[model samples]
Target: MNHYDSIVIGAGHNGLVCATYLAQGGQRVLVLEAADTPGGLAAGREFHPGFHASVAHSVNHFSAKVASDLNLAAHGFEAGADGHSIVGLGTDGAHVVAGAGALHNASDKDTAAYDEYSALLGRFAKALEPSWFRTMPRIGSLAVGDLMTFARMGLKLRLLGKKDLQEFMRVASLPARDIMDEYFEDETLKAALSWDGLIGSRMAPRSPNSAVLAMLYRMSGQAASVKELVNSLSGAATASGAEIRTGAPVKRVVINGDENGLGVGGVELASGEQITADRVISGADPQTTFLNLVGVEHFDIGFTNRIRRLRCNGLVAKLHLALDGLPEFEGLDRPGGRMIIAPSMDAIEFAFDDAKYGQCSSDPVMEVTVPSLDDDTLAPAGQHVLSAHVMYVPYELKGGWTDAARDGIRERAIDTIARYAPGIRDRILHSEFLTPADLERDYRVTGGHWHHTEFAMDQLLMMRPTYGAAQYSTPIPGLYLCSAGSHPGGDMVGAAGHNAAQEILR
Candidate 1:
């Protein structure tokens, strides 16, 4: 067997980030990817003869540490100044466009409330930001580092000075609907803000803490396509002498036995090739890494059951359209950036209600962006690509996602947009639709969940994934989890990967 110091399975952004950091720490690292390319969902592809769409769209939550640590900008990762501004569409053709410093077409009350709400949330998010970069302390460990880490967190909250601290604690677990009701009266503004907490999440906006945790975690980073970002990490890893192999799907993580318990010895490829490494880190989800790759026989029943209980059913569907031309919105001069189609908080929650009973929403909430409007290289001349991250479409549909069901969901999405932007349907030259099932088939992500698991309060911080394995280390020696499933949940942030690498280096 070919041998190395460490082996990382998968080439998702987090996996690549882990490999980069490991290699930088002087470990002989090897990254094995199942796909033919490196970017995983971050890579763009052509579905039509001339039009292309990114596998994943929307870029408002990537970590700066990953970029700076990997020196991605120097390696061709361009950060566009064009940040995401939301345009909330109303049912009767009314709209509100909100940017960093301004809220267009809103009443004075809502506009002022928007500024105050954003600033207060920004402060809380900044305070919580440090926790994203570090691994959570192991449960029951009395180590000084762990004690100090916990103390620092407490001090940060205390420093919020009584009133804000009480407010933050009270609202952290409250329903998003309640928060919106208290802060703003504009239905459009409430829906726009509430959508952030439930995007790609299985939770409804009204679920307790769903709004605060989801939106706060999302606000933790900037959003952008990380194709160049991946390239930069890959380049740095290689420069540090790491080996990355595309199309090398790992069959299983190989374990060897000794007098003591078992440990990860290496990995076996689908082609029957075997490679050995001292440590094996999986950037795949816990289910994929533990049950599928490692096999349940090696673990205790308790551990296997915990992995099985992971909440990973994905509720979002992705839709892309190759437009003949840019479609005009009712009130917007431009159609790029993040545009929301949820008319009210009630509408957003009602969409989730359908999925609760295993049905696709007739009216769904969607986060939309026309990347071609900003990045012209994505489409051919005189054409544009519309990528919509649609929600409330269950992975397990009412009767399964049959051909007609797929078409039904597709039309509903397009029609929903048409209600806000007329002539959108006429401009479509081609379209590609992906249910969670399609995402799983194409990306090999378990449950087609982009974040590996739901980012609920139970699956975050010290209890993330589980209590015993929250610090990246698994029960099996030499095996660790570096996926979004581990900590900080998901959203293209590389904190989990960066923190996992830190644990291994230590």
Candidate 2:
């Protein structure tokens, strides 16, 4: 029988990183993944042979500090400058972006305005850097550790004083639209900035506290991002001596019925076999680990029922398209950050509003990325891989996802892309669409919440997942949570996993 020091349930970035760190500490670790491949949502799989498109992950807002500290480059990861997205506002206009150091660029005239806008983004990033060092609690509702983290983090802000607090307050506490409006006069700029505030969130542009996402996003960890971060996952995990099982499915975590409350010491797999360990780390979703697989035999109804009430609406989807040639836009040379496919900010917001009411957005919003323009690894010579990170897909639509419904979405994306790049419809050699249902089943995201749960105020910080569950520990000791479902809610910070690891080892 092969026993291990620690067994991680999922090989997602967070799980892998945690396993790596633990293994590096000299404990034998094993990463068991049900999926054939790793990198869960952050994964990059070739949609068609020789055509690679990154699904689910559309941004590298992953902290740079985390990357530098992890030394991911040593593990083999490289990125290029062109990963930026040029967000267009439906009509022929400039694109607002966050890629590269320049921030944004407009293919249209008015180079001076672009320069000024770009400079402001640089300033914003500077102001955010100091605060990045502070340890932030996981994204959901606050926990005791979160409170302690907040208190410690708050000390770093003494340099900002009261004025900084007041000025920064709007960006974190107000509606995202209002904050973007404060920064840019251009409607396109406003739309682009506001669009991100609600990414992977249940909030809208007008939702209070939605703007915090914008501030938190600029909190780049120094040098780390998507690919680099994933590379770190491999090293930290592999070097830690954790034997990673690429295709093993842990059907359930076996709870030994000891006097210590069935105290989670082992796991069972679909093969009808069990592996005993000193501890079992369920790196999967809390609900999936407890309710779906383990059943109520190991949980109290109050805790299990609360987990059931977790509100997650799988509303986001990613469309990967392979183009024979690079797309040429009307004003610009190629596709960049975001294109206002819905026509206007009103259109985009309306789509989100409809999604709120159990219906799909009529004309959804898209943050398009042309990775071939930046990274050649995605495709063959001169070919392009276009990734469209779409939002406002309803969890339960007017009519659930069907062939017709999915086709409608495809048509919408095509029409939108064509508006910016004429004849783009003809460029597609192959394409793939993943709807909410597909996302839920594939990633086991509990309603496809990439953020794990809703990002509303009620679900943020200490309130996330549950009022106190965000701390990455159950009320019981010797058990821990490590997935995005824990806290600092999402966006690949891996804080939840790191925080949990520290606690278990402490």
Candidate 3:
């Protein structure tokens, strides 16, 4: 019988952000997290006795506005340049290093092309950046505010000038492979450049529609550790007077059916403790929120069908290795940056081809980061922790995820890494590989999608999580969505939560 102004289920970064904003707006907010700790996918966990890693090991593209608004720097949040460079590892010890607007160890033509590519994309990303944080106006809405949103978007693109605007239009929907081919001659650098576009979602270099957009989306923001980002957000939320309770699993969203139709009463805990609130904001994925927690009966047939049809099966997996010592790549003195294992666009495409058929890629491509290089606290003094985002590992394997199957993929990942770092196998003290299924179970995100759902054209912007729910407010009264499933999709970015809070406050 405890009552509050709002109840946010799941203490993911988005949820924490929404709670902080709402609390700051003078609402009595309570955030409930099923896990014993907050941070959702970004939460740090100790897989081994002395090593720590999160599903999302690195922070890229977290909202600077959100950080500044929350005064996160005061809470120990650092968002600036991700000091580490990105190195595209070559088989023959010829690596291509990408820095701000420059590429090292590439052909002269390719190097010059990279500068133009960076400048053009940088302009395009800057133009589109505001849309990511704004509430995407509902498609076909005649509301003046919605029309103004459209006008602002069009103006941003227009401000890019006729030539750049035309170029943006032409390149915006091009496949990652096509763009890379157009920009660079070095296959390794092309593959590395395209990796950002296809990293989390079910996409490859050749896959068209929104890959370039995804790349542009990630082009903004600096890198911070997941621990720092989550901790600061949690601290800010609590400091702003939002109460967060971990280990409180919501059994279901309590629904009240009156003449006005179905509405959220609050949430009932797994322990059968029902809490009351004026509104309930879900930080869980769409399917889990609707089918599992809210129940299908509360929604109409169309809404239910759309929610069910959402393509949320995650294709990415996480690999964490506890190394006895630092891993030395063939070309580099120290593995101090984000190292990409993909050799070419074809390599990425082939990996995707296998995964789309319910098989783990024989040659998996991954982005490896030795966070301990920047922060010694990740591992013991001499030891190190290696984290990688393994691509094309399907949620539903050929025969489902067996211990042998998991081990098979895990070995393949380590073997893939060992190719770049010849002595990496010898350095490994312990290894943990999490498939999409494992991610789903452990992170409480349906399909284990880091974005909660696919970031494809159909599931992005105003159409995200489906039409009626895209505005953050759900079809069900007194219920809203503040998770990655909402408009603008996912990332460590808190835009979805910030936008959701704005809508609620409005």
Candidate 4:
């Protein structure tokens, strides 16, 4: 048996981040990963010959504090200049570009309101920034630190002024559809913005607090591509004295009792090797960590049920196409940037309706980006890689995900893109599509959920994963969860991992 001060399960970005912090604190740590590489969904992989794409396409809004703390930029991470914009495609070969330009079919009134809406959301997001990085305070426990956190949160709201404070609360709970309808008249703009809120979520555009989520998503840091990011974090971890082992899958968390209930001893690998450690922090999802890895026999029924109902089913499918050349979209001003394919709010709602019943949407909404346009290293000379997020893909397909069903989805996505960019099919050299089930198989993410859990009000803040383990501490001693399923609920931010390390150090 190998022994260490701490063993972190899963060497995903968060796991790496957690290990980096712990090792920086002088604790001997090891990160065990199931895959050949780290970064989990955020890591870039070769989907087709000579073309690379991140498992999850978007560069999550990373925290500057985390970046500074981990010295990411010092390790060679860089983001593209700040001119990226989203183009919303219409059926009739027309498009609306959301940048510093006029909106197609949008009135001046709608334009002014859009500005106000963005500024208001920006203020609200700024107010919420403090909470996003720190641990969520316990509901009933009033420790001095917890009370100070609450006071700071309340002060942030108070600083918004009485009128803005009242309005912020109202907007925070309002559905994206309702908020968009109230602020903008153009369906194109509304749909483009609302799609951000719906990504990775099982919720439709009409779900409450989705507007707030969209703002948060909008405010996220657009960092370097996943490959660079993973390399940077991996470098940081190793430099901080953390040992990372890839191709190592943990079979289960080892637990033992010594007159004080159950406590994690370490982890047992699937290869039957046992590594002993004083503490174990799981970077895997909550359900997988608890029920699957730890086993339900150790947990009480109520906690088991809580883990069982975590709502982590992924509703998004990642699509990557290796194109012979750069594809063209009619009426799109720029040659390369992000594109939104949801024509209207109702269209997005209809797509959600299909997924609601376990059927793939006939016209799914997507966010398409050609990374090769910005980072030429992702593809060969003159060639390109198109990455897209096809949404409303229920984890449980009505008839299950069949070859025919997957083909249908692939074709539907290509066909939809062809509507905006004629001859796009001819440009494709090869294509790769990963359904939620595929994500599960490849990433070991239960239900293929990118966030490890859905970002819902019911599963957020103190109630995240569960109130019992909200602060990263599990019911079992010496065990902790550092996955996205913990506080702050996903989307590439490593706060959960960083915060978890802080807790473990304490």
Using TM-score as the measure, the top candidate is: 3
lDDT of 4 at 56: 68
Residue 331 displacement (Å), model 1: 1.5
Measured with C-alpha atoms, the lDDT of residue 461 in candidate 4 is: 87
| Residue-by-residue lDDT tens digits, candidate 4, 1-506 | 37889899998778998999999999999999999888888877988778999876656477667888998887877764543566777777666676533344457887788778877877887878878777888998879988988888899879989888999878787888898889988888889877667778877777765556656645755555667778899999999999999999999999998555888899999999999999999999998999889998888899999989889899899899999998988876555556899999999999999999999888988889888887798999999999999988888999889989999998998898888888789999999989999999989999999679988888988888998899999999999989889988777778899899988888
Worst 10 residues of 3 by lDDT: 78-87
Over the stretch 1-506, how does candidate 1's per-residue lDDT look in tens digits? 38888899988888988998988898889999998878677766787888877666766778887888877776676664555888888767677877665788888999888898888777778778888898887778899999888988888878877888888888888888998898888898888888777787777767875568777777766656545566676777677677999999999999999657899899999999999999999988888898889998888889888888988888888899999999888777778668899888888889999989998889988988888877777789889999998888888888788999999999999999998888899999999899998888898888889778878777889877887678998988999999888987777788888999999999
lDDT of each: 0.84, 0.66, 0.92, 0.84
| Candidate 3 TM-score, true structure as reference | 0.98
TM-score of 4: 0.96
Residue pairs of candidate 4 with colliding backbone atoms: 61-220, 61-221
RMSD of each: 1.5, 3.7, 1.1, 1.9
In order of appearance, the predictions have TM-scores of 0.97, 0.88, 0.98, 0.96
Off by over 4 Å in 4: 99-107, 217-222
Task: Kindly report which residue stretches of model 2 are placed more than 4 angstroms away from their true locations once superposed.
Answer: 79-86, 96-150, 222-232, 258-260, 336-343
Clashing pairs in 1: 59-223, 59-224, 60-222, 60-223, 61-222, 61-223
Ordering by lDDT: 3, 4, 1, 2
Q: Evaluate model 2: give its lDDT.
A: 0.66
Of candidates 3 and 1, the better by TM-score: 3
Instruction: Tell me the deviation in Å of residue 77 in model 3.
Output: 0.5
